[model samples]
Target chain A: MPLTINNYADGILHGVSFEVQRGENLIILGANGVGKTTLAKVLCGLLPSDAVNIGGMIPSQTYSEERAKRINYIPAKMEVFDSYLSVAEFLSLSHFNQTISIDEALSKLNILHLKTHSCQTLSSGESQLVLTASALLHSAVYTLFDEPTANLDPTRMKMLFELLKNDTTLPSKIIITHNLDLAYRLGFDVLYLKEGRVAFHGSSEAFFDQTHLDALYGSSVQKVNNHVVVAL
Target chain B: MKKLLLLTSLLLLAAAPFFGQIDLPLDKLLQSGTMEHQVFFELRLPRVLLAFLVGGILSLGGLVFQVVFRNPMSTPFTLGVASGATLFTAIAIIAGFSTFSPLFAFLGAMLTVIVLFAIAARFQNYDPTALLLVGIALSFFYSAALMVAFYLSTLQESYEIMRFTMGSLDVVGFNNIWLLGMVSGLLLGLVYHYRKAFQALLTSYEFAFLQGIHVKKLSYTLLFGVSVAVGVAVSMTGPIGFVGLIIPHILKTLYRVSADKLLWQSFFYGGIFLVLSDLIARNLGESDLPIGVVTSFVGAPFFIYLLLQRKS
Candidate 1:
C-alpha cells in the first residue's frame, strides 16, 4: 500500500492529503517556515496522528517492527546524545539489511575513515554523510530525507544525487530540500508547499516550466540551460 | 592510566574496612574472642558493604537517568524520587512511626513514580524537559512538606530527621547488607537487559523510535526499576547525594566510553567512590561526620577539575 495522509491537520499545516506509492520517489519543496519538517515528522509517526496511514496501518498506532520497516525520517542534522558513540556504533543501531554491512555503507558514503570517529565530533558535512550511511543501512521501505544536501559540498552532493536517483535499498525517498537545482535534476514528481498548503503537486516537467518557476520564485530564480538557477 | 586507576580503586577498597574511628587490630580480631572481631564483622564490614551497594545503585541510577533523560545533569535523585523518600521518612519520624520509616519511604518513592508517569501519559508527545520540570516542581513541593514536618516535630524528632537527611552508613548486621546486595543485583540486571535500547536512545529520541524501539515504554520501565531500587537505597541510607550525580560522569571521563559500555563500570566505581568517601567520613574526625558532606566536599572539586580538563 502507498504511504497515505488524508486530511491531516497539524497546527502548522492543515487539510493535508497525499499518497506516495512504492518505488515512486517524491520531492517536497516549500519556502522557509512552511512546515516541511513538521509534515515529515507527522508522516514518520514521530508526532502521532490518526490522519496518516501506510500499508493499511496508522503509523503512530502500529508499534511493531513492521511499522519501523515501513518508514524512516532522516532529519536535517544528526543528533546524538552520547559523546563517545562512534559513527560505526551509531550506524549499527540502524543496520537492518544483513547484506550491506556498516563498513559497506560507510564506504559507499566515502566515510569509512570516519567509522571510528565519535559521532559528536564529526563536522556538519561529515555528519551529513554519516546520516546518509545510516539511511542506506536502515533499508526501510519509505525513507524521508530532510535537506540531505544542506551541508554537503559539490562532490558529496553529487554522490548523494546518484544514490537518490538510483539506489534500490530504500524503495521510496521523499526528499525535502531548498536546492532548486538539485530538485530539478532529480526529476521526481514535486509537491510544493506554501504557507502550510500544497501549492503545487505535479510532474517535474510541469512544475519546472518557465512560467511556473517565474510564478513561484519570481525574479529571484531563472531557467538557464534547462538548469534552475538564481538570477544573481 | 586505566591500569593505574583500577589499581588505586582496588587498593582503596582493600584499605577501607581497616581505617575507621575505632580501629580493629587485625591480631586481636584474628583471635576471635575480642570486641575487635565483633566490631570488624558486625559494624565495620556491614557498614562498608552497605555504602558500596548504595553507591552502586545510585551511580547506575545516575547513568540511566542521564541517558534516558538526555540531560547530563539528570540523576536518579533529580526527579524527586529521593526527595519523596526523604519527606516520607521525616513524616514517619515526626508521626512517631519511626519503625515503619522504610515502608513509608518506599511508598513515597513509588507514589512519585506513579505521579510522574500519570503526567507523562497526558502529553501527546514525549518531552523530557517538561517531565524534568514536573520533577523539579515535585521536589519543591516535597521540600515544603518536609518543612511542615519539621515545624510540627519535637526537638528530638527534628534532630532525628536531620540526621537521616545528612545520610549515614551505620548498619549493625549482615542481614540488611544482603538485602541491599540483592537490590543492587536487580538494578544491574534490569539495566543490562535494556543496555542496547539505551544505546539506541543515546541518539535522538526520533532516531531511536525509527529503530523500532518502544522508546516510551522502555524508558518508563527503566525509570520505574531505577526509582524502586533508589527508593530502597534512600530508605536505608537517607538520600546520599552526588554519588549518583558524579560517579557516572567520573567513569565516563576516565573510560572515555559510551554509557552503555560503562554500565557495570559505573556501578563498580560508584561503589568504590562511596567506600572511599565513607572511609574519609569515618577517620577524619572524632565523631563520625555525615557521609553526604564528605561526598560533596570530595566529589565537587574533583568533578570540577575533570570538567576543566575536558574543556581545555
Candidate 2:
C-alpha cells in the first residue's frame, strides 16, 4: 500500500498532507524553519501522529519489524551517545536488510577504513557518509533522509548523488535538502513547503519551470542550460 | 593492560575475606566449631559477598541510568533512590523501629520510583531531562524531610542515622546474600536480554525508535528493573556511593568498547572495587572505615585522573 499522510498537523506544521506510492521517490524542498524536518519526523512516526499511514497501518502506531520494514528516518546529524561506539558497530545496528552486508555498505560509502574508529571521533562529513551507509543497509520500504548532503565535500556529494539516483540503493527515498541544484539534478517529484504549508507538489518539470522558480524564489533562481541554479 | 587489570581484580576479590581486622587462622577456618571458622564463614564471608553483590548491582544500575538519561553524570541514585532510603532509615530510627529500617528504606525507595513514574506518565512526550529534573527536586524534598527527622531524634539516634548514611557491609549470615544474588541475577538477565535494543539507544532515542524499538516502553522497563534492584540494595546496605558513578566510566575507558558490550565487565570490576575498598577499610584502622567513605576516597582521585587523561 502507498504511504499517505492525510492532513497531518503538529507544531509548525499545519494540515500537511501527501502520498508516496510504492517504488516512488520524492524530494522535499523548503527554506529554513519551514518545518521540512518536522514533517519528515511526522511522516516516519518519530513525532507520533495518527495522520500518517503506510500500508493501511499508522506509522506512529506500529512496532517491531513491521514498522521497521515499512519506514525509516535518518536525521541530519549522526548522534552517538557512547564514546566508544565504533562506526562498524553503529552500522551493524541498522543492518536489518539481509541482502546488504555491513562491509558492503561501508565499502560503497568508501568508509571501510573507518570501521573501527569511534563514531564520536569522526568528522561531520565522515559521519554523514556513515549515516548514509546505514540507510542503504536499513533498506526500509520508505526511507526519509533529512539533509543528507549537508556535510559532504564536492567529490563525496557527487558520489552520494549518484547513489541516490540509483534505484537499487534504496526502495523509495524521501530526501529533505536545501540544495536546489541537487534536487533538480535528481529530477524527482518535488514537494515544497512554505510557512508549514505545501507550496508546490508536482513533477520536477512543472516545479522547476522558469516562471514557477521565479514566483517561488523572487527571480533569484534561474534555469540555465536546463539546470536549476540560485543567483547567490 | 585490560588483562592485567582483570587479573588484579580477581586476586583482590580472592584475598579480601582474609584481610579483616580480626585474623582468622587459615588452619582453624575450615575446622567446624572453631572461633576462626565461625568468624570466617559467619562474618567475613557474608560481609564480602554482600559487598560484591551490592557493588555489582550499583555499577550495572549506573550504566543503565547513564544510557537511559544520556548523561555521563547520572548514577543509580540520580533518581533520589538513595535519598529516599536514607530518609526512611532516619525515620525508622526516630520511630524506634530501627530493627526494621531495611523495610522502611525499601518502601521509601519504591515510593520514589512510583512517584517519578507517575509524574513521567503525565508528560505529553518522553522527555528524559524533565524526568531528571523531577528526580532532583524529589531528592531535595526528601533531604528536607530527613533534616526534620534528625532534628526530632536523640543524640544516639542521630549517630545511628549518620552511620547508615555513611554506608556499611556488616552482615553476619547468608540470608541477605541469597536475596541479593537473585536480584543481581535478574538485573543481569534483563540487561543481557535487551542488549541489542540498548545498543540502538546508544545512538539516539529517535534513531532507536526508527529501528522498531518501543523507546518509551523499553526505557521504562529498564528503568523500573534498575530501580527495584537498587532499592533492595540500598535497603540492605544503606547506599554505598561512588561505585555506581565511577565503575561504568572506568570500565568504558579501559575496555574501549560500547556500554552494551561492557555489561559483564562493569559488574565484575564493580564487585572487585568494593571488595578492595572494604579490605582497606577493614585493615587500615583500629575500627573499620565506612564503605561509602572508602569508595569516595579511592574512587574520586582515580576518576579525576581518568578524566584528565581522556582530555589529553
Candidate 3:
C-alpha cells in the first residue's frame, strides 16, 4: 500500500502531490516556512484534508485502530498538556502493538530511567527521546517523524540515525529534517520542497550531487567525503 | 492520611442530617410520628442528598470543562450555562410563571448548549480557547439581560430572583432528590465510560489524535453530556458556584494525580465538600445561609492556599 497526495492545496501548499510505496522510506527536506509541517499534518490527518490517502483509505476520514495501524506522525516538539502524565503512562496509551512492551521501547531509546518522570519536567532532548519511545510503542506501518534529530546531542543523533538507517523499528519511515549529512547517510528517496512545491523528487545520490546541492542550497553547503556539510 | 480523611468525611456525611436548629436524636428519628422524624425525612435528608448530588455534578462537570477547554479555570458555568439558567429563571419569576421556573431554567441551559455547539461547528479549527471566549461573551450578554429582568419585575419578584441568584438547597422531599440522583448517576457513568478518552485528552489534542482517538467528537460528546447534566442540577439548586471550580482542584492536590484519575475522586470529595458547606450553613446561624454564599466563602480561601502552597 502506497501513501498518495493529489492536487492538495492548503493555504501554504498549492497542488503539491507525491507518493511513498510500502516498505519504501522517504526524506522530506525544505527551507524554513516551506509548509513541510503542514504537509506532514495533512498526511497524518491532523489537518484534515481529502487530498491525501493511505493504503486505499482517506486518513482524515478514517479513525481509531484502522487509522492508527496505517500511519503515525511524531511531531517536532513534545506537546503534553497534563503536568502529571508520566512517560510510562503516555507510552502505555499508544501501545497499540502489544508485542512491544513499554519498558522495552524505553530501554531501546536509553530512556528507561525517565519512564516514571512527568513529561512536563523533561528537557527538550529528553522529551524527544520519550517521543521516540512512544513512536516505537505505536509501531504503525508508516511513521512520519518531523525533525527527529533537531534537539539531539551528537551521540543521540547517531543512535537515531542508526535506528532510521537499519529500519529496526517501523517498516516505512518518512523523516522530515534539515540535517543534510543525516539525510545523505540514510540513503532514502528524497522529496525536496521549495516555495510550496516539490522542487525535486529523486534518489539520494542524485539529490546530493555537488551541482544539485549548489542549486538547492546555493553557496551554503559543501559535499566532503560523500557527506553533505555546511560550506562554512 | 488518606484513610483518616475518608473516615472523617464519611462520618460527617452521616452526622449531617441529624443536626439542625431543631435537633433530632436517634430515638426521635426512629419514632415514626414525631416532628423530628418528619424533619429528618422531609427536610434534612432531601436537602443533604440534593447538596451532594449537585456538588458531584458540578465538580465533575468542571473537570470535564477544564479537560475539554484545556483551561484550568473553566467550569460548567464558564460557558454561560448557569447564567442562561439564571436569566430564564428571572424571566419566569417576572412573568408570573414562577412555578415553572425550574422547567424554564432547564430550557435555558439546554438552549445555551445548543447555541454553543452550533457556533462550534462553524469554527475553522478545533480551537477550544475560541469557544471559551464565546462562552464568556454569552455570559456577559445573559447577565445584561438578567439586569433588564430585575428592572422590570415587581419588588417581590425581584427579591425571588435575588434569592435564586444566591443559590439554595431548599428541597422538600424525595422526588427532586431522585431526579438529581439519576442525573448525577448518568454523568458519573458517562465519565467512567469515557475515562480512557479523558486520559488521552489530558495530553495535547494532537497527541490524542495521533493515538487514534477522535478528539473533536469525543470532546463534543463529553461537553454536551456534562452541560446537560449541569443544566438539570442548576435548574434545581439555582446555579451553585465554586463547587465545580474548587473541588476538582482540591482533589487533584490531595491525590497528586492527573485529572483523568480523579473523576470518581472528584465526585466523592465534591459531594463531601458541599455537604460540609451545607452543614456549616445550617449550623452557623439561626436561619440557614444561602448554600452558594457558604461554598464561595469556604472554597475561595482554600483554593488560594492550595495554589500558594503548590507554588512555594
Candidate 4:
C-alpha cells in the first residue's frame, strides 16, 4: 500500500507498505511513532491515517478486512474483564460455538491453572498472556499482536512464536514487536518501518543480522549479547 | 425459549387479582360478573398491568444508558434525564397543562439527552467521563429549574408536584398499558437488532467499531429508544426508579453478563421487580406511597451494599 503525507502529516502514517501471504508470519519492526502500530490499526479496519490514501491492496498488504474477518488482534489495550467474570466466566460468555472454552484456551497457552482466577487477581504478565490466548481463542484467519511478548520471559516468547508460525489451521500472523529475538524466531516475512516509511522489507534472516538492524534503528540501537535493543 | 415461554405462561396464569386481599372468586364472579369483580377488573388489574409495563420500560431504558455510557452507575437520575423530565412535568402541571404533562415530560428528557450528547460531542475525543460530567451538569440545570418552581409554588401545588416527582404506581382511571405494550414490543426488536453493537461495547468503543458497529448510529438509536421508553414510563407513572437501575444489574449477575443475554433477561427481571415492588409498595401502607419512594428506599441501601460488596 502507498502511504503519503498531507494535512494531518503528524497523523499521516509514513514509511509503510507490504503484502503478507497466506499461512505466513510477518513481523513489523520499528521504533516508537514510526507507524508500525498505525499500519496494524488500518488493517484492523480502524480508519486509516487521517491523511488517508493509504494506498491499495497488499497482494502484499498483510492486513485487510478479508484477512480481518479471520483476524484476532491482541491489542496491548486490553486488561482483564472484571465485571463479575472469572476467567471461566469470560470464556463461556465469549464462546460463540466457533471458539474453544476458557480452560481449553488456557491449556493451549499453558495457563489452564488460571481457570478460576479473576483478572484483577492475576499478575500483569499472567493477565497479558491470558488475554492473548483469549483473544486468539476465536482464531480468525489472522492474528495480530502489538508488542505481545512485552513482559513474558524468553520461554513464553518462544512458545508464542511456535504457535504463530506453526499453526496449521490458523491464518497468517503479523506480530509487531520491539523484541528482536521473538521477531527473528517467528518470521516468514519482515517489514521494518522508520519514521512511518518502510525502511526494509525482506526475510527474517536478512533483517535480523546486527548491521541492518543497527542501521534502521540508528544510534539508539544496541546489541547486548544476541539480543537487539531499541533504547527507549 | 421454553424458559421465556414458561415465564410468560406463569405470569398470565397468576395475574394480579388472585394474590391480593381483593380476591375475585373466579367461579362466582364469572357466573354473575359481580360489582366487586367488575371494580377489581376496572381498577386493580389495570394498576398491576401498568406496574409491569412501566417497570419493563424503565428497566429497558436504564439498560440503554448503562450500555451507551459503559458505566454501571448511570441511569435516568445519574444521567439527569429523569430529573429533567420531572422538572418538565412539574412545570407543566403548575401551568395547568394536565393532559399534556406526559408529552412535556418526555420532550424534557429527550431534549436533555440530545443536549448532553451535543456537549459531549464537542470534546476533541470521545470519553465516557466527559459524557458523565456533561450529563450531571445538564441534570443539575434542569433540576434547578424544578427547584425554583417548587419554591414559588402554593402549598397544595407543592404537595401534588412532590407526589408526582416522587413517582407512584397508584395510577387510576388511566393506564398506558396499550401504548406500553406496543412500545415494549418495538423496543425489544430494536434491542435485538443492535445486539452485536451492545456486545462490542462490552470491550471498548474502538474494538466495537472494529466489529462493524457504526458508533454514531448505535449510540443515537439506543439513546432514542431509551428516551421513548423511559419517557412513556415517567409520563404514565411519574419517575419510578431502581426497577430500571438495579434489575438489569441483578439480571446480569444472575446470568453470564454477556450484553446479548443481559438485554433480554433485563426485560424479564424488570417486570418481576416492578410487579413485586408495586405489590409491596401499595400494600405495605393503608394508602399506597409512590413506587419511586419505595424503589429509592429499597434501592439506595441495596446499591450501597453492592458497592461495599464490590469493595470487599
| DockQ of each two-chain model | 0.78, 0.89, 0.76, 0.23
lDDT of candidate 4 at residue B50, scale 0 to 100: 81
Q: Residues B1-312, candidate 3, lDDT per residue (tens digit)?
A: 889998998898888898888878889788999988899999999988888888889989998998888888889999999999999999999889999999999999999999999999999878788888999999999999999998999999999999998898998989998898898989899989999888999889988888889888999899999999999999998988998899888887788778889888788888899999999999999899999999999999999999999999
Regions of candidate 4 where Cα sits further than 4 Å from its true position: A1-8, A11-25, A31-39, A47-67, A70-72, A77-108, A111-143, A168-172, A187-206, A212-232, B1-34, B113-129, B173-175, B256-259, B306-312
Candidate 4 structure quality by residue, lDDT tens digits, B236-297: 77878777778777666546355455666677667766777777776688777677777878
Error of 4 at A117 (Å): 7.2
- For candidate 1 chain A, which ten residues in a row score worst on lDDT? A59-68
Measured against the true structure, the TM-scores of the candidates, in listed sequence, are 0.97, 0.98, 0.98, 0.80
Ranking by DockQ: 2, 1, 3, 4
Q: What is the C-alpha RMSD of each candidate to the true structure, in Å?
A: 1.6, 1.0, 1.2, 5.1
Candidate 3 residue pairs that clash: none
Best by DockQ: 2
Stretches off by above 4 angstroms in model 3 are none
The predicted structure with the larger TM-score, 1 or 3, is 3
Instruction: State candidate 4's DockQ.
Output: 0.23
- Off by more than 4 A, model 2: none
